[model samples]
Target: MGWLALDEGYEISLVEGKVAVRRPEGRQLKALPKALRDHPEVDRLRRLAEWLERHEAACAAQVDTWMVSSLPVPTELLARVWPDGAWQAALRDLAVVPDDDPDEVGFLRDATPGGELKVVNLDGETVRLSPRTVTLPHPVLLPDLDDVREFAAELDITQRVEQIHRPTWAKPADLEPAATEVRDYAGGVFPTRFGLAARATGLGYRVSGGYATCKVRDSGRAVEAAVWIGEPYWDDETATGALNWHDEDGRAVRLGEVGPVAWSEGMRMAAALYAGRRIEEGGDEA
Candidate 1:
């Protein structure tokens, strides 16, 4: 099931489908310092430690699929459990298994375009296949069995995947005015490096100043106009200073500043590069 990081103690969801602070034997932690145990924050840490330890053991025993929330666990605990550095790899194999399967699972294989490939939890409904590896939903890290069961009921589990895109990192492109104006006229928001590449490739829009400028064409005719987008950074305080959109002549043509946006343009640009796309411009500008 899911291990929720509570304010004081870690809540471990066990096989019986119930959340408990102690282990399966019902032995509660009684020796913890009163101050540390009572403190809401410290209590949370203790619970997380216990959760980690138990799950670590389970995984060591070769159990499959552990679901964890977005909260990052301490590196020490991760290392202790994963001495061989195969936790992530092991976990990937164990996701999306059926309810009847035990907590610990083994590798399963099937034929693919590249020949026979093995993945954790071959019996799982969702088989995420990639060129080099396969992945399944981690059971421990899942929100809860009920949630997963509900999900399975709603979604088909027998679908075989053809591809999985791994993440990558890349530098942002020097954008041109044509691209910037196209982004602006398209009523753009969160103009990420990836978005810029997409717009230039005719998949996304362009933006410039507040009003729309760039127009989309269909069959050599205009269809939709572009608009200026907000800043591309994650926070507002860092939005100052105009960014120079470059052109082919190596001169700056469009100018803009980082504005309030949720996602970072750099991250988006990196994702696009990971997807094997290129971003080009004419020159740079202020």
Candidate 2:
């Protein structure tokens, strides 16, 4: 953005998402000048930067929701939002499959004003696709995930919203039908329950009822995966507990009944919580 002239032959502009000051001679200063420290323009620019940051975060979150749920996104909507920097950043480089033809998978590259999409196919060719709707399938649902990852790597693709490279855990075939919880990520110790809960929330999971929970929509059904983090008032030492899933009605869901998205997300949350556990000496997890 261009610098705006202030009252004292000083120019101010946002640089690297911060207010930067420059002398009239065009020399930039390391810090904001003392005279203009309380300028209204500076405060306004700071607020604008804050709003931009929030907008970027919100755009990425919405894109993640669409990918995680494997929902079909309209090309028209994509085209409309393509001009926005935040939206474009969130949408670019995502692996998209046409709703009508799932085999036509490509990395999104551009969205035209006429609602046409330009993508890079697996053949190392830039192709134009005009699908009415496209799905950014979750990594767990991508049949050719390995191929896609390899292709993305070759293209030097990096997505603001995690999709292709997101960690995933698949449900085992030999699981007991009646089992309702997974103990793989259990026993992760933390100094305090508050610390464990903070870690879960910091990772974008919700803290409710003494559990760190993630809700996902899989196969048109709403399922919530929860990992016990201990009671809210438990200030002493705490440990992460088993991960479990429940249906929309709050009934416990058996391990075999959990959908692929729900299961993967559940395990992902559990693993993330466990990864933040306090480490003991010798580089061992506590």
Candidate 3:
């Protein structure tokens, strides 16, 4: 809106004080005027602009899939795609964990097909790593997790990277009225899943890269609940998770120990994510 306009394959932009016409590649430009509307160069730029726009959109969509899946990516593969500006931009700076240890997280800095992959380790040192697979971790599992989450929020990448660490109930043996409807995503960060994230955010909950968080009162006391979203392999249309609840003293509540309000809210959140999913005819979703 500030200066660029896309119509057909042509990009009409304001460069300095005059109208400039060119393809989205920013190559082959001509000054625009009413008399030059039929210029052959303008027609050529328009065609190139159209192709560029479509390619850009395709790249963005594919990158979105990679972020959502949090798949264990091969550095060699990334190196091949890194030549494309859009692809490189999307893959840069994401938190990655080596295939070996899920606990050792690093920030992806560079990739080389046959050379060492480079990353800034959790200790903030620049180092070359040769992990079998590099995975984009959900923000919840990153070093300085809170800070990483803050950065994601600033970039609005939360929902895209949903494979972050999910909060377990802390004591599975202590839970009561165990979830019969919950879908557990092994890579999911939410106990229930991602679909409910919007609803939680609309209700003033803090929807972070890994969880939808908020404090609710139960029996005149405040409890914190962090709802996790599951990983994509297990989550397709709807998302799910456990209700990680904290007591007035800020300790995790044991299973089946939550009061009426807390329990209702937890189930309600799960239901929100499950609301629009279509069940499969044979009991498996399509």
Candidate 4:
């Protein structure tokens, strides 16, 4: 049997009648007969590939939310997600704080079936999951992880993935940030709060306190927009009836004075959010 490249965490090989896991490998199985394509081995390999793709996406999405909201994830939740290889792969390498403790952080190594977790501490020590909950800390929060932070930057990792090791700014990156635009929309346009938040979130905004906001580069200056939602609670089932923007000083900026890029982005955010609202007792559905 000839070995193929790595897939997920396994090496694959074409053996006997079909391509299967030798514990790792890839897609070019042209030599196998069409009838054997449905072989158990082939099917297992195919399923693994599909699962890996989904797992990677799920990991990234969860990490993004953790970064934006700093929400604490329960350790029980991680253990639950760990049985799935995709989730295990997505979670295995990053640093996590169990119980949001600042004293120590550990890199997840494995999750035990008995609801236990194995982690490698910064000092290269193996430690079990002890906290009831875990949080993926932003890099800036760890002042001692300068090496990890520097290495991540040298690799030019995307901020979304690197957020597991990167610090987030409480304020926009630009100094003395300003409001660059004032965007408006009628309440009828957006009916679901989640849809609007999702739109701004898709555009890199953080959703919190009934506001979908983002820091945008406007004419070489970092400007921010806090698009207001009708309610702050996630369960309220309300959309942003109308939206407004505030500068770093918390002052309002008129649309006429806003920069081009910020204006377009704010409008885009409003429109996208407005379009994504869910159908509720109506003829409209998407």
Candidate 5:
């Protein structure tokens, strides 16, 4: 195996039939195929592979990543056909109608050698099959069945592809396990982190069973506040507190509880207090 230092916080490790990403923290992130990572001229191949990956990601954002056969059609498009509402109940029998993309349909047909071939009628229905089965001739082919089996498959793929866009915000580096932070806070009458996040989000929290139980405003209503009381010490209903809350009109209600307020918020609050009055120099948020 050989290694090459690459630009932009990366180390590329190449073995006989594999290429591994040696992350900056000295961890192996992923292994790539030999064709891409283990060429005779490996340094050149690694650079090329990285560049191509970044380029494709950039391109996918601009061009809908779905509808790109290399990628898949987005599930959100299914929602467009079936937006959220009581009306969706009626569409229980309906199928996703795909747009006519000669290119995508042609590609699938070419890729599927010796697969079944059938001509679709002009009315966006199928004239093939003994029972005169109906179908829509868009790229997202949905087989017409009373059980709506094909529609379910199409919907699943669409949603899976759309999830690619969901935000994966990196957690702060100092995200200690909740139990440790909670235990320290529990030593005091009031858990420190619990107070801060509650104040920030306008919620309430308390410490019990080695965890901070808190409640927040959700959906314009209040509910139970949940704290992760140490698992071994907790009973099913004992750990959670029914949060006392008020509506905008000053009516009391219950909002659901959340687990120990996230430790990062607690850390930030602590740091803010430490840095008060601007006393010293280069201390960053822990």
Candidate 6:
């Protein structure tokens, strides 16, 4: 953005998402001058920056939701949003599979105004695809994920939304059919329940009642995976508890009844919460 002139030979502009000031000679100042600290322009720029941050976060989140659910997105819609910087950042470099040809995986590169997409295929060649719809499959659903990752690394691909490199856990084949909870990530200690709750919210999970929950759609059903983090007002040291899944009606879902996407997403939430546990001086998790 170009600099705006202020009173007494002062100029201001947004730099690195912050309001920056400069002298009339065009030398950038380390900080805003005290005299102009409360200027209207400064406040306006600050608000603009905050809104931009929220908009970018929302774009990334929506893209993540589309990938997690393997939702088919229209090419025309993608083309419409491709020009926006925030949308481009969130959608760029993601692995996109055409609905007509599920076996062909390509890294998204560009979207044309005519509803065509240019993607870099496994052969390292840019190919044009005009499919009406494409699916950004979850890492768990991608065939030969290791090869995709290797190809992405070779191409120096960096995705704003964690797609090709997202951590995934496969549902175990030997699970007890009647089990309703998984204790693999249980017993992660935090000094206070607030800390545990904070970690859950920071990781984008909802802190509801005594559980940190994530709701996802899988196999055309709504499922919620929750890991007990403790009561909201509990101030004592707390430990994470078993992770379980529930149906839309709040009934406990048996292990065998949980769909693949729900299982992987539940395990992902559990592992993320556990990873933030307090560690003792001996390098062991408390």
lDDT of each: 0.32, 0.93, 0.55, 0.59, 0.32, 0.92
Clash counts for all predictions? 45, 0, 21, 10, 13, 0
Candidate 2 similarity to native, TM-score: 0.97
| Candidate scoring better on lDDT of 3 and 6 | 6
lDDT pick, better of 2 and 3: 2
| lDDT for each residue of candidate 2 in 1-286, tens digit (9 for 90 to 100) | 9999987889999887888999989999998878888889999999999998999999999999998888889999999999999999999999999877788889999999999999998898999988899998899998878888998999999999999899999889999979999999999999999999999889998999889998899998899999999998999999999999999899999998999999999999999999999888888653
Among these predictions, the greatest TM-score belongs to: 2
lDDT by residue (tens digit), candidate 4, 1-286: 4564443444456453335553322544345555555666567766766765666787776765563344577777877888875566556667777774666677677877676778767666788876777767655455556765654455443343555443232223342344443344435345556666667667566887777776554544455656667575454466555545556676776544555545545565565566666656866554
Show where candidate 3 strays beyond 4 Å.
1-31, 113-115, 140-144, 150-286
lDDT of 4 at 92: 68
lDDT of 1 by residue, 140-253 (tens): 233344554444444433322110111212223564324332221121223354344344345222444322122212122222322222344323211112222333343533
lDDT of 4 at 16: 38
Name model 4 segments beyond 4 Å from true. Answer: 1-52, 150-161, 164-174, 177-286
State in Å the error of residue 197, model 6: 0.3
Tens-digit lDDT track of model 5 for 1-286 = 4566665455666443345666577877665434445444456666666765565444433232222112233333333433332222322222222333322121111101222222233233442221111222222222233224343443442222222222122224454433222222221112344343333233223444443343323322333323332333333322222222234464533212211222222332333322221222473323
Lowest-lDDT window of 10 residues in candidate 6?
Answer: 277-286
Model 2 residue 261 CA deviation in Å = 1.3
- Residue 240 error, candidate 6, Å: 0.5
Clashes of 1: 45
